[model samples]
Target: MATRDDGAGAWYHRGQVCCTNRKLDEALACYDKALELSPDNPLLWRRKGFALIKAGRYAEATVCFDRALAIDPDDATAWQRRGYALACMGRKEGAVACFDQALARDPEHILAWQSRGWLLGTLCRYDEAAACYETVLRIDPDRGSAAWHRERMRERRDLAALASEVREAERFMEVPACIREVVRERDYGNAELARAVLREMVGQAERPAVQHR
Candidate 1:
């Protein structure tokens, strides 16, 4: 129902009202009309991108975000939304990079931090992911989801460390045949040298024993 007399801003406002009412298709039409009138407007591109996201057209949404960013490279929200669209497409590393761009522009961007942490967590980079959650909690202490994620990452990190320690302990517990040779030397009367080698093997001569109370 928009006429040639309607200005681009008028069409943009109509799109906003349509979006508020959940009429995504109508919103997209209005936005398209607005874009035709003012294709260089970064806000119109970003708004269309958000509407595309709500319509579950993530791939198209990314294109819209790309256009917005091309027009205004410093748009932190556009970068964040591009990352979110990439995430929905299962392109995690790409999504992380976009989120990183957003955070670079606006360090206190909570959504970027949360999304980056989520992607890192899925990648099993628990320590880095935990650090992201810790940053979020520092920025907003009452964020329960970030707190919960931080605890989970901490647990996973501890479990990874414990697993590594267990592997190391298992390796040390494997008795080498060199010990048997040392025992044989002791039996052959080179007892002092054998004891010295045995002490070296156990690291007892170089390391002090723990004092018991």
Candidate 2:
């Protein structure tokens, strides 16, 4: 047992080092070795899940995260990682539920909050997404990326509103007589000359209609 534990520790350390170096395959190999020695270590399982996620093996990563969560139900990191893997698998609803679980375990988990916000954005829940980002900003005022994301969400909402307003205004907009003429003459004359004529027509159109007293 002692020898097996030592091997597990060594493999875990090697896996962590490889993960830090972004060598996902090597990290996975070490994690596999560690799991062989200590199959019940939740931490090792979580590490393997993260490495699989980095390697773009999201389905396998989800299983690993689920295994870790089964071993340690209160593991907020595992929940958050599972949420990410679910999101990558296009299971948005499942991802959101996992994120909620992570937040329930640790409300101050910034990554969980961020992931929830991103999922909300994907679902087109801009208001909720903005609120989530605002919460993140409140928790970490130095989070420049969160601030930027909040601003972008606001911009998207505002642009959508502006577009609706433009559509409504278009119902009242009338093509000016000169613009109509320019369009009619465009094919028969130089485009520049047509534009010049259109500009003069606009000037005349803007002038109040002359009325003899």
Candidate 3:
């Protein structure tokens, strides 16, 4: 690390101050100055990437993150930030992969879990998404966003599962009446004792489907 006496350190501090003040362009300038003095500094590269992301220069931010990762592959925060940049650019699959990389290095990374959950939800992988949010809630029980999203994902997953079961039931009903009778008699009850079990199943499933809408 550069000492306070070094020009690079001074510049890096200035960049941090600017970033804290939301002066992203000025922060980028200071980071560039620091990088000029210490081009091999991965921290400087990552800081620049964060400034670019704040500016909505996602493509440039990704390039800076790429440079940072090339310098140090084990940086979980850099990987997570890179995923965020990719997500901003609409590269969702790429973002998810980057989040996976971050989690591989640090399973307790809350932001990575949250971001992955959001992406999975967008992709309609509700069960997996809900699992991610469940992990987030376990790690930080006060995370209201994660808690809210978890419930939403669970509802969606349940609806999807129920719909699939209903479809299977419909298909089963379409089978030969002989087969249906056998199934009904074996699993449900004899016709003398059964009260239209298959119809009841379909009706229950369809009720939820209607409520989901």
Q: Which one is best on TM-score?
A: 2
| Per-residue lDDT of candidate 1, residues 101-198 (tens digit) | 99999999998898889889888799899999999999999999999998787666655544443344345554345545434333333333444454
- TM-score for each prediction? 0.70, 0.77, 0.73
Per-residue lDDT of candidate 3, residues 60-79 (tens digit) = 99999999999999999899
lDDT of 2: 0.82
Candidate 2 segments whose C-alpha is farther than 4 A from its true place: 165-213
Candidate order (TM-score): 2, 3, 1
lDDT of model 1 at position 204: 48
Residue 179's lDDT within candidate 1 is 44
In angstroms, give how far residue 44 of model 2 lies from its true place: 0.8
What lDDT score is found at residue 68 in candidate 2?
A: 94
> What is the C-alpha local distance difference test score of each model?
0.82, 0.82, 0.83
Please write out the lDDT profile of model 2 over residues 99-125, one tens digit for every residue.
999999999899999999989888877
Clashes of each: 0, 0, 0
